[model samples]
Target: MMIEDVKLSIRHRAQRNYERQFDERNRVQTDGIVTLGRLTIESPNKNMGSEYVPSPGRLIEHAFAHLPPDLREYTFIDVGSGKGRILLHAALHDFKQIIGVEFAAELHAISKQNIAAFSAANKHHPPISGVLGDAIDFIIPDGKCVFFFYNPFGRPVMERVLENIAASYRQEPRKIYFMFLSLKHERGNDADANRELLERQAYLRPLKSWNANRGAWIKLQFGSHKLTMYETADAGNPIKRRQRGANGAAASHLE
Candidate 1:
């Protein structure tokens, strides 16, 4: 086997081993991958979705730590939540609500079962539920929210989802946070495309300490994935306000 393929195989094996223990500790069965062909649900946008790969707990904790200090004010929504691994983790927080949106019928059912198992063992968590539907058709909920994405779908679906978010913000201006994590070196990865798409949004502001020399965040690595965070600029933040104003017609559309 090629050296790169060998390395990848090693990583995948290690990850599965770790997740088996992770599932045991959390009393849930959330390990393994289900390719697009294996997904049993029939959805118009199913092809846009990538395979179901559960997020690692360590990387999740690293990413969540950088979110707004008071998670109580924001609802955690995991788009393409796979088997609800992230939802269970979010339930440990004090968020107003915890939700996972997965379109695949098989994965969605598994996620619901996992959530039930998690809740039974840990009864003090916030409201947690799974919504099975195409993310493109899912309406952005009212109030502040922290949207988490792990390269759930292709660029087209992601673009529509972002547009919906912007439109929702226009109808009712509110704070929103976005966390996107994806493989760092994988070719044709949607995470990279989605991150660039998000960067192009005039109204969204990236949250990270910049390294001007490198022209990127000082650190964005979480295991094998790269994580990028953003938040809707506060109306009063003069810098971002000015940025939004400078976008001309595009900025006007957001209003």
Candidate 2:
């Protein structure tokens, strides 16, 4: 066989072995995605964010390691959860609740199946549930939340989702940590929309932008999908007060 063929075979074997270890049985490839027009929750016309890819287990582990120990109580939510791959790995930890939201009904069903299988094997984990709907309309849980997004949707949907999340904070006044993966950021895309929305909103603070190149987890040569973390500002934090005051000033100046 040719050297190139040997390399391709090795790559396939590595990917399959990775899946075998990380519960990637539920169609991790992007072959069956509908790309023509808007499909149910995904916007193929306006934003065009539809492709199925599982989050790397090593990246997730590194990200979670940065979070505070108390955040283990926060409900873990994967926005645009494809097949519950992240949920299965998250269950390996001790989160309070685990949830996956997928727009496609078929994907949602598969997520349910994955969760069921994972739960059956690891019976000591927390509660896990998968929701089927557009993430824009999905209600945020009424407490601290750990939201994960892997370039799920385009700008329009991301803006709406952030609006919903911000509104939840407005009503309940609690902490929210956003862990965004693969943030190259372009206008009208998921990463850009999320960054713009968060910047425009006054309640949250962008905390860290980790260097994915320096990352030791997963393959050394993964994509440049940097994991950025953001959290809601606490009432007493100086930055929060200043942000609120600046927002008030901006509103007053507009009048």
Pick the TM-score winner: 1
Cα error of candidate 1 at position 251, Å:
9.2
> Where does the lowest 10-residue lDDT sum fall in candidate 1?
210-219
lDDT tens readout by residue for model 2, 1-255: 996576556545655576665654533332233442434545333245556667655567767776667656689899888777888767767788988888777677777877777766665988889988778767899777889888787777787788788667766777778887763433455566566666665666676544333444333324334567777777333223223364456431210
Model 2 ranges off by over 4 Å? 1-16, 24-47, 183-189, 209-219, 235-255
Q: What tens digits encode model 1's per-residue C-alpha lDDT throughout 101-193? A: 889998999999999889888879999989988888887888889999988988999999998988787776778888887877868657778
Off by over 4 Å in 1: 1-18, 209-223, 235-254
Scored by Cα lDDT, where does model 1 land? 0.78
